[model samples]
Target: MAALTPDTVDIIDPDLYVRRGYPHDEWAVLRREAPIYRYERANTDPFWAITRHADIVNVSRQPELFHSIQRLFVTINEEGSPAPDEAILRQLLNMNPPEHGAYRAIVNRRFTPRGVQGLREQIDRITAEVLDGIVDRTECDFVTEVAARLPLAVIAEMFGIPRADWAMMFRLSNMMIGPGDAEYAGDETILETLQRARMEFFQYFSQLCEDRRQNPRDDLASVLANGLVNGAPLPIFELMSYFALLIIAGNETTRNATSGGLQAFIENPAQWARLKGDPSMAAGAAEEIVRWTSPVIQFTRKATADTNLCGVPIRAGDELALFYPSANRDEAVFDRPGVFDIGRNPNRHIAYGIGEHFCLGANLARLELQVMFRQLAERLESVESAGPLHRMRSNFVGGIKHMPIRYRMRPRA
Candidate 1:
């Protein structure tokens, strides 16, 4: 194989990720040779590939200059136009500072350390239930059976969704996030599938909003449905968008982290033993796992004004893709960028991102991961792969579609 260069590499290719996981080799090359390389590919829009950790932070911090509004998320250049209702894309993720801050403040209190701590007991219960189901079995698909369940239950309960609707939520999210994958991809084009998923989401959330408005409850759904923003009800589109964001953000990324974390442990048995011996390291382990599996691959932001980053001059309207996985493993910051050390201290991986637009559910995600791995560390006795690993065919989210594992566990004492 020839050496990969900025010109030869195609990082945004969804098929590249499905066939071979994270292009760390390609990213390493870019990080060293051209941390701010201009990536121009056929079919996809040209953008600067921000590979270094410091550069990503520099771009993420100044939301005023590098706006998130122009380009919300990175697409793999699918063959169809998106839904005409572009208002659905006007969620919190795509907003700029003042508006972003305001919308974020709506549910900000619930995701704070204090708020997430309140849900710790619930998370513990959910984790126990999920593990209990697999304790009697010798083999299970960890991604679907174990890793995916806990977060789904937790987030569903938060929304006051019935247990029956969990499957619906799961299917919808997969369609939205992994539309490029054969399993999720239908006869329709990727954008059309996305539009259909969004409509399905809209229909469900619209009814939920109506129900909550008539008889509000303590769940996040009810809070958003009836809650006032700026002394008025939130627009219907924004409300639905809010629900959709929470459902996907709260579920998909966390499950991937959990599955990827376990995969790391299986590969690095010594680290598993280290964590198993001292469960107290779960906090650090969670952080390490997030860094190891930066689920959100890349998000594009457009320069609001012509400026410079890393000595490279940026023209206004130029878009840049901040590669989170690469930033998480940058050599300048982390001690051993490639090593997955569970007890890596002072680990400041920006898997959840940095600055004003940092993930709103970050604290909750940390809590979920910490509690989850702690339980696994205490009970997971032995484990290994039962079949070939399957990854989501999407460059946007580094999703593990299926990870079958055979394992034993010490019964909960």
Candidate 2:
């Protein structure tokens, strides 16, 4: 393969992601040769690419220095789109600490480890129901048949959405984040697909919000619809953006992680067998899978003030893209980083990221992965890749889009 050059390291190019898996080799080069690399493209802004794990951590920890409030999250190319409230994206994805903390606190308790663990039986039930759909099949596309359904079910239930609408939500999420992919967008440009999806999302969620207000339930949607932020009920746009984030972010991250995690198990039979023997290893297994997948590819931050990162000078307002996939594979952090290990100890992967902006749904996502994999380890007789694996042609949120897996399954308990 030819060496990746400056022109090819944008990290947000959808073509590169479709052709290469996670851009590992290119990131390795960046980490060792130029950890704070820079890249520029046509009609796009030039920004510093933060590749090394430590650099990502440093930037994340100091949110005051690297602010997300500058009207962007990771990529400027996809910024400034039509939505319910065009400005709400900033409030949701780019809020500063004081404000970010307030909104995050609205429903934070429901996503904590304790809160998430409380739903283990429910998660297990959801997993079981989804698995039952595929139990009799000799071969299936695990991507859609199994992995995609689990997160949609869990999150839909959380949002108090009707079961009938879960599939719609999942489809809208794909169209929202995957405009660059033919499977999702077909011929639509990024902004066009995103705007179209946003309209659908706004139309549906707007009704749901009103319904929740009239008939509140013990769900996240009801909470957000009725809840107040800073002595004021969330503005309509903020409310809509919150729902949009939940639908898109909530679905894509976990969905991709599950799909990619299953592929990992099939690829590393020994690791799969290890888990089969000891289901308790599901904890470490979750971290390893998230590390391996790193579905939420890159998170960006804008410099609030001039500073230096690992001796590299940075200017105020400069965007820094944190390549989470690369950080997870940093050789300095994990032993044999390239190899997949279900039982890797001290696996300090920054997959969910660090600092205040760390993934709020991390606990829930971890629990979902653990429960699903544990069930597989118990009931799965054997499994392996059965055909060519296809990935979502999306650069931001991506994973196996079509994976044919041949597997034998034992009767469910």
Model 2 superposed RMSD (Cα) = 2.5
Q: lDDT tens digits, residues 378-397, model 1? A: 89889998988899988888
Best by lDDT: 1
Judge candidate 1 at residue 15 and give its lDDT. Answer: 85
Q: Please give, for residues 24-133, the per-residue lDDT of candidate 2 as tens digits.
A: 88888888888998767764567788888999999999978888753343443544433322452444467887889999888888889888888888899999998888
In model 1, the Cα lDDT at residue 326 comes to 97
Q: Which ten residues in a row have the lowest lDDT in candidate 1?
A: 81-90
Report clashes for each candidate as comma-separated counts. 0, 0
Candidate 2's TM-score: 0.94
lDDT of 2 at 246: 78
Q: What is the C-alpha RMSD of each candidate to the true structure, in Å?
A: 1.5, 2.5
lDDT of 1 at 328: 91
TM-score (C-alpha, index-matched) for candidate 1: 0.97
